[model samples]
Target: MFRSIVKQKIPFLDLKIQHQQIKNEIFQAFEKVYENTSFSGGAFVEEFEKDFAEFCRTDYAIGVNNGTSALHLAMIALGIGEGDEVIIPANTFIATAWGVSYTGAKPVFVDCTADTWQIDPSKVEEKITPATKAIIGVHLYGQPFDVEGVSSICKRHKLFLLEDAAQAQGAKYENIPVGGFGEMGCFSFYPGKNLGACGEAGGITTNNKDYYNELQRLRNHGCKERYYHDILGYNMRMGGLEAASLGVKIKYLQGWNQRRKEIAKKYHNGINNPAIKMQSQPDWADSVYHLFVIVTKNRENLMEYLNKQNIFPGLHYPVPCHLQKAYTHLGYKKGDCLNAEYLSNHCLSLPMYSELTDENVEYIIEVLNAYDDE
Candidate 1:
């Protein structure tokens, strides 16, 4: 007699569970926004900006519409424009490059390190030319990149250094927060981010008063005062509702990040598959594990097997930005970024969230260890 196997359904990320945990506080924040009618950038946005600045240990924070807008404003404030070249990791999201492109600058691609899957600082100098204006180091999947090496390169080359801390809200390197390491760090408050808002939101952290003031104007049609436009800009201001939601979520960020770390530890200890290659975390990095990625040559089969077991996973990016159809004009070929191309083919993101239970993690690990190429 044949018997049916029972499968436990696991989601890649369960935002509903997280919402239920903080539903009361979130609703109360919404009520306050309603009472004040602070729909545009107002007191709510200002309060969250203050809180986020203190949280990131920076002198100033300016909230914007989204991470892309934040990056765009940063590029403008730093005086990057047409004919300028900005170096960025080839494996990162296209938004990083989009920010540079929006400012009429070309994005120069650099290969990522194999072990850390971060921008290879050793390859940076070779890409620099007279047009090189900045170097963007992305803290991919919550792990802080080699800030020291990248910062040294920036200093020696007299280029601006920017940190794309979109995936690493509470992560740290050498005990300093990731957002405070560069001249300006950009953060995303997308619904799935560590410190997410109800809707889209983003911000920038900087110690330079002039940069801060310029960013403030840039996000609001370049208006320092009502009816006074100082420079041409976009309507990239953050809404009060999103700001209020973020305010409520920020208070729980540290604890949530700690929980995520605990979950990552369990995944590290439980999944002992020879085919799986986990990301390496450096001693100086305290990653929040936004997405627990595993690399395997048999990614397609593994994803299929997990689906059969009712477990869903994800791919951080199946296509590297350099090889995307949108960037064909840049004249990049398949072999331009070897490590990033390798990663794009093999990387798989497992279920990772603060709300995931031990039972869920163990079951997922068991299934992963049980996968067979046959």
Candidate 2:
């Protein structure tokens, strides 16, 4: 048996180790930006944009202040405004809905699939109305939603398709990168994301030249030129320091993602507890395993047990967006998005990071298996 009293604490995530591995490269990136004095948005940001665009296999990429800004700008660029409606997964982080709400559009929430914990494409159409102008398919927890299923509906209904890839930097759907699959893909490079920057940062990817140009203007005060303003816009440009740091980090993203997958595999195969349920990976999804979420009716008990053993897990979201107080005005009741509400109450994320050792993974699995669900 493992030690009854453990001294090692397994955190839900540890960015410090990740930072340590790439410290020299990140510092060099910072030094270059500092020397250039392009503090706001300049060459460093531009270089990262180009590299990121290439990585996602998109023709163009636009860096923004943060992921929320990226989503808001993408919606605005799509002409979503007051009286318009957007379809999004109720299971997602509130930011996904915020993007639509910020654009003065109503966010219609859809339930998630029971197994994959993704937006259930089958349930999306029922929520669509004449006001529906777009659908934001979130690649929640780094697993791409059913792109083909959702895109088919979008095409049939003449609605814009946006990819919310905040947790899916290196993820793919059907062997193709995510961002390019939709009209526009929004990514967050927050300090905790798979390809996180040193600070808040985000990027948009698209193959549509027109949307790309409009997004560029929208993020930079609606100006193509320094002093000329083309349209009313917000000051949401990404910082040079964040961009430089992101550029350096992006180089290691694929490797880090691979390691995350390896750890997830260990958890998947080792956790034999019948009371615990894991998210299912469809054959079409090449997830980066941003968060290895598991569901259990006895979540609070399990959490307390893990805490005693110095193993701490986290909740992706303890509340579903449709049922949140902020969206109460939307008039959605508890059972409106059934699967999402169910998962919200039951799901807890395990410790998932590239920095975790094989022994760390085995220990986590063992602890989980030993948990008393009753």
- In candidate 1, which residue pairs get closer than 3 Å at backbone N, Cα or C atoms, i.e. clash? none
Question: Can you give the TM-score per candidate against the true fold?
Answer: 0.98, 0.98
Write down the lDDT of every candidate, Cα atoms only.
0.92, 0.92
- Error at 227, model 1, angstroms: 0.7
The list of candidate 1 runs beyond 4 A from truth reads 1-8
| Regions of model 2 farther than 4 Å from truth | 3-6
lDDT of 2: 0.92
Best by TM-score: 2
Ten-residue segment with the worst summed lDDT in candidate 2?
A: 1-10
